[model samples]
Target: MARSRSRSFITTEKPTTYDEDQFALPNLNSNWVYYKGAWLVHIILIICVKILLSSVPGVSSETSWTLTNLSYMLGSFVMFHWVKGVPFDFNSGAYDGLTLWEQIDNGAQFTPAKKYLTALPIGLFLLSTHYTHYDAITFLVNFTFLAVVIIAKLPQLHKVRLFGINRLEVE
Candidate 1:
């Protein structure tokens, strides 16, 4: 028997999935995230941001870490979730509607890459919290960003847009 695909009540529209598109050719846009170096890039970017923020006058360690955490979190969310469509035009717009996260691994959940991607934000949040000395305000702010990043990766929220944000126009 075939399993039925379910949608959450909050899900306003179903997302178009391209499982077969992977067999035709590889998606350079999403596949790059799997590279060993790509993972390192995230860490390097985090460290760079931490340093940049730290160098600014009057920016304490706590503030620097919090800024780094927020910067990475927002960038991750926008890159993997907020933005739709592929950067390359090779696929003839086949992936025009899917975000990088959805395009990765052909929308499979809990893959090794996905797990690592999910964990990166959590780890960063922890690092920020520790560096911030567990300040209540910093913790809450970092936690909120982390929460959004984690929620965006959830299979349930795949291709979902709340309040019509980021929904592709169907003209």
Candidate 2:
């Protein structure tokens, strides 16, 4: 009688920590540094838009408004995605020092509240843009909305939980 052989599958390697802070600002390879660089790029784009709007004379109001709103929307989208991979502790300094898995877990914990907070500003911005035809007002509203999104994601502020039964560390 031939006996069936049972194959054993076992691994003994410990999971690696996802600490990116080593590559951060001081190191220039961290996700936080990358986020800041991306933010600066967005700022430069906004400045270019402002300059173009002022220097060029025959650009239609519709065209200018479209460009401005597009910039804001693009910036917000970039921020939203960039934040997903960043390991930031709102309670700590600019650098969270937490592993990627820890940061992701923390973010997930507050994602529900964050989603609601994020949507409110976006909805208000859309409504304001739809009703306002003044170039200046539109610019102000668009800029303000973009700023709000950026501010809300800052490590110092991102951990805030709104209308939640469980309080975040920062709360």
Candidate 3:
């Protein structure tokens, strides 16, 4: 006895208004200037941290690990900054934005896979810092400085509008 294959299939029609709405898209004048600016800020911080690390001395192998870990943290920070810059609708600390790749169909996607690209360094640094010998204080200072610089810049870069205010005038 030969059994016949079932031919039951349901195909729901898509809403007609969907295509119309998609075609008549709203214009989004996203300001990417801030994104690039953030990138520059990260780059500068990375360099400065490296410089400060090199200048400080009397580092044990463990302290060296800490320094390396600091580097990993800094690199992750830079990547995060860059990722944040990618254009997406953001709520005022209310809702999370979509992932970079999710917005790729809209002609936007972060160039690199930031998760692993940034994570590997962090993992290696952690391993080295944990097992190897190096000065906790030296690493602390350098890492703290880097963090302070990066964090301080965020408000100035994103929130503060200084277009009309004169820098020369003392407030």
Candidate 4:
């Protein structure tokens, strides 16, 4: 069978809308982002990346920090925005179509965790820009990455698939 492409501008995910679960067990997929020490671990990981990159002989401090920022940005964007569905089957596929960002906090908007995740990239961009000594080129590069990630996290864009980019083809 041929898979038809979704040429639509925005694909709404209403078909997979939320269903009340009687079990009420935690969703293992997204709950971890709000778990204790999650923030600390995130910061520690960034520090480790900075340290590791700095140890590279050819890598300057600015480059290392920029690379660190890029690494975190890329990873977080994919983890939060790009990738959908749960890795574990514990939730019985309730979260199978939602990205981690949408799955977090039961899809609430402007929650503390959401706010922190939003602020994190901006903080990294500011730090990278400052450390790069306000270099024009690096600033733009960092800003672009930050913008793309931030836009995808916006409440208005929830479950939105622009240009059907990530829509399930069979649907």
Candidate 5:
């Protein structure tokens, strides 16, 4: 027996509105069950490592300071990429993702005041120090800001306009 192709008497329709709850992002900050414990763990670990390195004799304090500062710089760059909601382009052979200015145009809702509050002091300190010297206070301040971005900003990226829950839902 051959099956006959048939059409339904009723017409099909696309959905007009998605359920609001369907768009809720994972509350990584408050939802501790789904995510690991407080960000203070990482902070404490980093501080412990720094203290241990400083304790070792013959390890130049300057070198230790430089390495710590370099970590902040590298982390800042990586966090900038993730915060802008850009994916890593493996084939490009370069990380030429959207810059911060481009992200703003694309509806990134970062508070300008907050960003400048954290960034300006670090920028001025770097410039004033001529980028050659590393002070513990300045390094600590920069790392603290970077830590906030790491713990908060990356998670918030999951709720942005263009790149939020839609992407997660699709995935």
Candidate 6:
């Protein structure tokens, strides 16, 4: 007679619990460092683009410079607010897991004074750009600064440095 085999129904894997402590507050210093670095990089890019636009053979230098500065000012304003809104990956005591838009939608409020204070740097930078003469040395300095900023902000490299992870890893 042939022998019969038995089938098994139990599994070996175990479920794991989520650890709340794993989500610590992000380093505020690191956040500021990233924010400042990104801002500098953006400014350098704007300056370089302005230089290129001014150098175009057929374009009027005055008009080009004016347009570039105007655009840069507007971009600075927008970027400043946008970056301010990005949530740091680690819980930062403030708000976690909420974008700026989400905060606005949820009725998180800001005062007029607060808004003006945030925009102050942008206004100052616009004035500086308008008043400064764009020479070759100035262009070179801006480009060099921008290049340094880019290196500092490189995703892989930055993760290893003080900034720890500037962005949240979803999933």
- lDDT: which is higher, 3 or 5? 5
Q: Over 4 Å off in model 4, which ranges?
A: 1-4, 21-24
Q: Write the per-residue lDDT of candidate 6 for residues 54-144, one digit (tens) a residue.
A: 7888866545655565565445434332243334444332333222322331222343323433344345344545666657665454444
lDDT string for model 2 (1-171, tens) is 321222233211122233343334342223242353543564466567756874679966555655666666655554453333333343224323232322432434335334443554465456546745757865675766567565645455443423321222230
Ranked candidates (lDDT, high to low)? 4, 1, 2, 6, 5, 3
RMSD of each: 4.9, 13.9, 17.8, 2.5, 15.1, 16.6
Task: Give model 5's clash tally.
Answer: 0
In the range 87-167, model 3's lDDT, one tens digit per residue, is: 443422111121222222332333333332333444454455456544677556655745543442332333121332211
For candidate 3, report its TM-score: 0.30
Listed in order, each prediction's TM-score against the native is 0.86, 0.32, 0.30, 0.89, 0.33, 0.35
Best by TM-score: 4
Measured on C-alpha atoms, candidate 4 has an lDDT of 0.80
Q: Rank the candidates by TM-score, best first.
A: 4, 1, 6, 5, 2, 3
Candidate 3's displacement at residue 84, Å, is: 2.6
lDDT of 4 at 68: 88
Model 1 misplaced stretches (Cα beyond 4 Å): 1-9, 12-22
lDDT string for model 5 (113-146, tens) is 2354245335533543454455677557556655
Clashing pairs in 2: 23-30
**lDDT preference between candidates 1 and 2, better one:** 1
Q: What is the lDDT of candidate 5?
A: 0.40
Pairs with backbone N, CA or C atoms under 3 Å apart (clashes), candidate 4: none
Tens digits of lDDT, candidate 1, 1-171: 322233333544444365456568788888888776988998898889888899999988888888888889899888999888887686767777678998898788999899999998998887776656857877788888899899989989877777666666652
* The best candidate in terms of lDDT: 4
